[model samples]
Target: MAKKYVDINTLKYLLYDVYQLEEVLNQDRCEDHDISSMNLILDSVKDFSDRELYPYLKEMDEQPAHYKDGGVEVHKQVGVMMKQGGEMGFISGPFDYEEGGLQLPMMLYTASSFIQEAANNHLTGYIGLTLGAAELIINFGSQELKDIYVPKMLSGDWGGTMCLTEPQAGSSLSDITTKAIPQSDGSYKISGQKIFISGGDHQYADNIVHLVLARIEGAPAGTKGISLFVVPKKRPDEEGNLVSNDVTTVADFQKMGQRGYCTTHLGFGDAGECQGFLVGEANKGLKYMFLMMNGARIAVGRGGAAIATAAYHASLEYAKERPQGRKLASTGKKDPEEGQTFIINHPDVRRMLLFQKTVSEGSLGLVLLASKYYDLKHTLTDEKEKEKYGLLLELIIPMVKTYPSEMGAQSVSNGLQVLGGYGFCTDFILQQYHRDIRIFSIYEGTTGIQSQDLLGRKLLLENGKALQLLTEEIKQTINSALKYDDLKKYAGKLGDKLQEASKVIQHLIGFAKKGDYERFLSDATPFMEYLSTITLSWIWLEMAVNAKNALVTGKKTYSEEFYESKIHAMKFYFKYELPKTNGLAEVLLNEEVLTIAGEKEVFN
Candidate 1:
C-alpha cells in the first residue's frame, strides 16, 4: 500500500494561510465554525482515511467491481466507506444544521474529501455521488420527498446518484429521449436508459436513489421541457412496504482504471413499473441540476488533483528508496568512492517531482479559492458582495474544472516517468493513477466544453464584470508580490502577462463582435490552457507571498523548509508553466482558423 499520498499540511496551509477560510466562517451562515473545530474535522477525516481507505486501494483496484444477478458488486469496503462517512457527517457536513448536518464550510469538506480521494480515488466516488445527490434533494425536493428519501440517503443505507447522461445523447443533454409520464398519485412513470452512471447500482446499499432528468409527456422539446425526478431502485408501496421499482442494472462498464467504481448502464421502467417523484417543479430540472454543477465540477477537479498527489508521492517514494545511479562530479565524472545515489538526488528526477508539486498543490489552491468564493457568494448578506463573489466564481469555474483535470494528467504522467520502468507495471501505483486520471478531463465536462464556456459564456459573464473583477484580484496579488525584491521581477512579468491577456481577449472579442463565432471559439481549448496557466501562476504567487510573510513576520507556524519549498515551487511555476501561455495566446490570436470547418476536408 502507498502510505503517503497527500500532504495534509498543504491543505491546511491553503485553507488557513493563503485563503484565510476564517473570513468565511465569521460570516452569518458559517459563524458556528472556527479554525480549531475545522482542524479537528480534517484530522479525524485523515485518521479515518488512514485506517479504512489507504490500506485497501490496491485491493479494490485489483478486484474490480462486477455486474451479475441484476446488480453490481463492488469491494465490500465500499459499504464501510458510505456508512462510516455518513455516521461521521462527512456527507452532511456542508448542509444546514437544521437539516441534521454539521454545517461545516464547503472548503473544509473539500479538504476532507481530498484526503480520502488521495487515499483511494476509486472507492471515494460512492460517497461523493451520494453527497451530491443528497444535497440536491435537500435543496429542491418537496417536503414529502424529503421525508421519504433524505434521511436514508444521508445515513448511507441508501446511495444516491444524478442520472444525467444517456447512451445516445452523451454530453449533449438536449438529445436525451428519457420520458416521465405523470400518474394520478403525484408520481411519474419514468422510462429511460442512462449510461456511464457512476455508483449507479451497488449491492451494499439497501436502495439507490437516482435524480434522473426526463421529459414529461406532451412537453416542449429540448432542455426546456425536461423535469427532474427522484427515482429509486426500490420504492415504498401505499402500505409503506419496500418493493422493487424495476430499475434494472443493464451492465457494468469495465474500464482500464478506477475499476472499483461501478459505472453502469441503467434501464429505467423496463417493465413500465418504475415510479419517480418530481423535484421542485416541472421544466426546471435542468436549472436545478445546473445549480449543483459548479460544486460537482470542483469535486471532479479535486479528484484529479488528489490522484496526481498520490501518484507523485508513490513515484517520489520509489525514487528515494530505489537508488540505481551514481552522482557525477562538477567535472562530469562519476565519483567511484561515492555509492549509487537515490534518483531523487538527480536533477531530472527532482525537476519532475517539483513539476508534480507545483501542479497538484497549486491546483488544490485554485479549487479551494473557487469553494471559498462559493461560501462567500451564498453566505454574504450584501447583494453587491454576493454578486461580486458569484461573478468571480462564474468566471473561473471552467478553469477550476479544467486545469486540475487537464494538467493533473500531465502531472501524473510525469510521476510515471519518474518511476521509469516500474511506473508502467502494475506492481507500482503510477500505472493505475495514469489510467485513473485520464477520465477527469472528460468528467463533469470535457476540456473542450469548459473552454467554450470560458470563451463564449464565462468571459462575457455580467457584461465582462467578472473578468474585470478577476483582473483586479490578480492586480492585488501582483501588488503584494511587488513588496518583496526577489518577487518584484515575477510580479512585473505577471503584469505584462495580464496586459497580454487583455490584448488577446480584445483580439478575440473583436471576432465575436463581428459575428465570427466560428473563429472566435475555434481555439477555445488553447485559450483555456492559456487562462488556466495564468490562473495557476496567480495562485502560486499568492501562496509565495503568504509563505514569505510567514517567514519574515517571525511566525514560525511552519518550518523554514516548508515555507521555502512553496517559494521555490512558485518560482518554478513562473519559469516553467507560465511561459506556455505565450504559445497558447499565439494560437488563440492567429486568424488562419484551420480547425473550423472549411471549404475542403483535410483529414483522411
Candidate 2:
C-alpha cells in the first residue's frame, strides 16, 4: 500500500499560502466555518484516505463490480467506505447547514476531495455523483421533487447517476432518443437505454436515482425540446412500501481500471412501468443538466491531477530506494570500490520525474483557481463581481477539464516510465494509476469536445470577453512577478506567449466572421494545447513569486528546501513545458489546412 497519497507540505502550501483559503472561508456564504475546524476536517479525511482507502485500491482494481441476477455487486469495502463518507457528512460538506451540511468553502471541500481522489478515485465516484445529483434537485427541482429525493441520496442510502449518454449518441447529446411521456398523475413514463453510467446500479444503496434526459411527446427535435426526469430503480407506493420500478440493469462494463465502481447499461420501462417525475419544465432539461455537468467536469479535472500526483509520489519513493546504474561519468569505471547509484541521480530519470511533478502540482493549482471562481460566481452579491467570475469560469472550464486530463495522462505515463520494467508489472501501483487516469480525458467531456467548446463557443461568445478575462488575470500575475529579479525573465516569456495567443485567436475569429469555419476550427485541439500551456505558465509564475517572497523574507513556515524546491519546479516548467506553446501557436497562425477532407482523398 502507498503510505502517502499526496505531499502534505504541498497541500498546505497551496491551500493556505497560495490560495488563502482561510479568507474564502470567512466570506458571507461560508462564514460559519473557520480555518481550525476546516483543518481538523482535512486531517480526518487524510487519515481515512491513508488507512481505509489506499489499502483497498489494488484489491478494487483486481476485483471489479460484477453483474449478477438483476443488479451489480461491488466489493464489500465499497459499502463500508460509502457509509463512512455519508455518516461523516463528506458527501454534503459544501452544502448549507439548513440542508444538513457542514457548509465548508468550496476550496476546502475540493481540497478534501483531492486527498480522497488521490487515494482512491473509484470509491469517491459514488459520493461525487450523489452529491451532484442532489445539488441538481436543490437548484432546479420543485419542492415536492426535493422532498421525494434529496435526503436518502445525500445520506448514502441511495445512489444517483446522470443518465446522459446513449448507445447511438455518445458525446452528441442531442441525438439521445430516450422518451418521457406524461401520465394522469403528473408523472411520466421514461423509456430508454443509457450506457456508461457510473454508479448507475450499485448494490451499496437500497435504491438508485437516475436523472434521465428524455424528450416529451409533441416536443421539437434536437436538444431544444428535451426534459430532465428523476427515475429510481424502485418506487414508493401509497402505503409507503418499496417496489421494483421496472428499471433493469442490462450489464456491467468490465473496465481497465476504477474497476470496483459500477459502470452499467440500463433499460428504463422495459415492462412499460418506469414512472419519473419532472425536474423543472419541458424543453429546459439540457440547461439544468449543465449545472451538474459543469460541476462534474471540474471534478474530472481534479481526479486527473489527484491520481497523477499520487503516481508521482510513488515513483519518487521508488527512485530513492531502488539503487541502479552508475552515474554517466563513472559508467566506464569498473572498480569494485564504487557502488551503484540511485536512479534519481540519472539526468533522464530526473527529467521524467520533474515533468510529472510540474504537471501534477500545476494542474492542482489550476483546478483550485477554477473552484474559487465557481464559488465567487455563485455566492457574490455584486452583479459585476459575479459576472466577472462567471465569465472567467466559463472561459477556462474547457482547459480546466482538458489540460489536466491530457497532461495527467502523460504525467502518469511518465511516472510509469520512471519505474521502467517494474512499472509494467501488476505488483506496482503505477500500472493501475496509468489505466485509471486514461479515462479522465475521455469521460465527462472528451478532449475533442472540450477543444471545440474552447475554439467555437468559449472564445467566440460574448464578443471575446471570456478570453479578455483570462488574459487580464495572466497579465496581473506577470505584473506581480516583475518586482522579483529571479522571476521577471520567465514572466516576460509568458507575456510574449500571451501576445502570440491573442494574435492567433484574432486571426481565427476573422475566419469565423468570413464564414470559413472549416479552417477556423480545423486545428482546435492544438489551440487548446496552446491555451493550456500558457495558462499553467501563469500559475507557475504566481507560485514562483510566492516561493521567492518566502525565501527572501526568511519565513520559517516551511524549510528552505521546500521553498527552493518550489522555485526549481517553476524554473523547470518555464525551461521545458512553456516552450511547447510556441510550436502549437505557430501551427495555428500558419493556417495550414493539411487535415481537411480533400487532403485525405489519396488515402481513400
Best by TM-score: 1
lDDT against true structure, model 2: 0.88
Tens-digit lDDT track of model 2 for 257-287: 8898889999999999999989988899999
lDDT of each: 0.91, 0.88
- Score every model by TM-score: 0.99, 0.98
lDDT (tens digit, per residue) of candidate 1 on 1-604: 4669888888899999999999989998788788999988889988998999988888888999999998899999999988998899878788888777877888888889999999999888998898889888889998888889888888888999999999889999988899999999889999999999999998889989999999999888999998999999999888988899989999999998899999999999999999999999899899999999999999998898899889888888888898888988989999888889999999999999999999999899999999999999988999999999999999999999999999999999999999899888889889889999999999888999999999999999888999999999999999999999999988998999999999999999998999989888888899999999999999999999999899899896788999999999999999889999888888878878677777899999
Candidate 2: worst-modelled 10 consecutive residues by lDDT: 328-337
Q: Give model 2's TM-score versus the native structure.
A: 0.98
Give me the displacement of residue 304 in model 2, in angstroms: 0.1
